[model samples]
Target: MHLRKVYTIARHEYTVTVRRPGFIVLTATVPVLGLVVAVLVLVAGRGLLAQVDTLVGAMEKPIGVVDKSGYFSPVLPAFADDFQRYEDETEVYRAVDEGRLQAAIVIPPDYVQTGRVYVYSPQNVFQRVSLEDSHRLRAFLAVHLSRPWVPEEVLVRLSEPLVTLTPVASRQETAGPWASFTQVLVPYMVAILLVISVFASSGYLIQGLAEEKENRLVEIIISSVTPMEWFVGKVVGLGAAGLTQMGIWMLTSLALSGGAMLALVAVSPIPWYRWGLFLLYYALGYALYAVLQAGLGALGTSTRETQQIAGLASVVAFVPFMLSGLVFTVPDAPLVRGLSYFPLTAPTMMIFRLAVFSVPTVDVVVSLTLLVVSIPVAGWIGAKLFRLGILFYGKRPSLAEIWYALRSA
Candidate 1:
């Protein structure tokens, strides 16, 4: 392995990537655009509720609410700030027909506990509803919570609604705390970006390799450096490029949303230590995936074949993200727990669960250690595959051939 050649490859990658105006614009400005969009959504959402009276006037017509309990349930008191009242659900429909209201609501007696709130509006016509519905529901729950009779169990029940972790014992999981888990969403985006990055870099790796092979330039580069040095350096340089782009995007995103940014800093509910854990896992995760991408790149005789291999790896990387919603809802389900221990899916699923709730220290230690150990092991295996894959081309090789590559010097 020649340091000189490695440095040269890295320098070339950095320069080529930075000098492309398209890459520069995308790398630098994308974060700003993302941040701006986020801020606009938050600001506009907050502002939309500012002028309640004006909003009331803007509604097309009156809507009705039915309590169905024979008692007059006070008109959502806030709804009074918006809609004119109608006699009943039927009358609300009539008023809608008469161009008097947009929709109607029916609050069944068990609406809160049952999660069965009903809405009625003209069929096949678009119906607009008021904002703060979530606020209204949450406020309603909070007030109900203040009542003397609501049990602690019911409150916790509503929060997760699934998993229902018993908190059997307390242990200091390296996962840290809740906010630390939000970074799971961070890697989710990372997974997609890095997968794309791997795709992009693998192209850079293989096409550069193959183009060299085809144009008779492979010998020129190899004469100056060993294949292993060149391969390792190219992978490192491009990975650095990916992380730099991702970091800039992350900081840019945070900077753009000033309010949330401040709130996150001030009231960060997640534990700080988990950041150490996140970095640990992120590095391991990225290394494991990037090396695989490198091996895939080294194997392909052509660019098209490289993509097929890269796409397969991308799907493998994305399995956790595809099931993120489930991971959020059922963090401790046997399947979730099982996959989280499995090397390929653990980073996303385990980290996400670690964020939302307390996991055992053993689980945390075992999972993180596995990923960390796997990184170099996988990279070495990939490097072997890569080193051998470089020379074997023309016909697609067998699993025996791939296995032989893995064992190659």
Candidate 2:
């Protein structure tokens, strides 16, 4: 319980972990690989874009338009090459059959009233028309319909709308599509990174625990330091190491992308406060799992066995991800909300919900409270398990015995 003893133990654990060759290699590998990939992309990006443009151009056969209504007489000069006028629907079909046309568009005579356009394209059974093809036909229709009413510049802007959103409060401008996409993407990325880092650091904890127990070193360590001090020290020190790894990976990405990552964060549609919540959830999630791992890890007789036992916690953590499709589609559904409040799944589920839509303030508060409250209870249970299991040898303890021990602790 002494602050000095806890700090000394924590310092020792952190120094030992960060200095390990495995830790150094694992930490550096990602950034080094990212740098190599970034360099290659920068060197060849222009050439790659050019090649893609050429390939697309070569593959895109001109679309045939049958203007039965005679409304689209002189095709717009802008779309002249992309669209070829065909007088006969039969001729258009023939051209399409011969692979000379990518698609055939038939304009009905009642196009003014019904506005029904027939499209013919070859595709597999499950396939739909390509977006580019549909977009081109729609653009052609829109231009002809609206050109007579709106100014030319206005009509052009209708298709290529480069909109920016500026909220009254933040006064930050965000690009339309990119910002929306980032709102959904960033939360998912944070959740995944949080889980990975927590497990990686906790894996170190369990591995060290199992090694010490196996070698009969726990007795010596415990004789010098109280169990609570040892447990708290390991958790704090390893959590710092995990935080350090996550920081390095993020910095590497920012450096590799030439500050593009920073720009994305600035324009992200996620509220500023949600980012803070993400950090809070990450810390609580890591602490809760670390406590669980410390207990379960001590129960195992070997490092591999310890990891296997500790991995059950990871399985529980990943349940939210497995049901992520539902979370994304129905963020406010009963099941998703329940998961969001459940301590084990709360961190990831809440993050997933936040990415998809705005979760209610009450739900956020409740979930955070649950995670905050669960850590101490888990710590007490873990302390009991660690205290008993660290010294006990031979057969693995049964659930009944563990329950009894918990009651006694």
Each candidate's root-mean-square deviation in Å? Answer: 8.8, 6.6
Evaluate all candidate structures by whole-model CA lDDT and list the values in order.
Answer: 0.62, 0.80
- Weakest 10 consecutive residues of candidate 1 by summed lDDT: 123-132
In model 2, the number of clashes is: 0
- Among residues 3 or more apart in sequence or in different chains, the pairs in candidate 1 whose N, CA or C atoms overlap within 3 Å are 61-100, 61-101, 62-100, 179-270, 181-355
TM-score of 1: 0.63
Residue 192's lDDT in candidate 2: 89
Residue 321 local lDDT, model 1: 73
Off by over 4 Å in 1: 28-53, 56-215, 259-262, 265-268, 393-395
lDDT value, candidate 1, whole model: 0.62
37-57 per-residue lDDT for model 1 (tens digits):
777877886767666544455
Error of 1 at 121 (Å): 16
Off by over 4 Å in 2: 43-46, 53-73, 76-134, 137-175
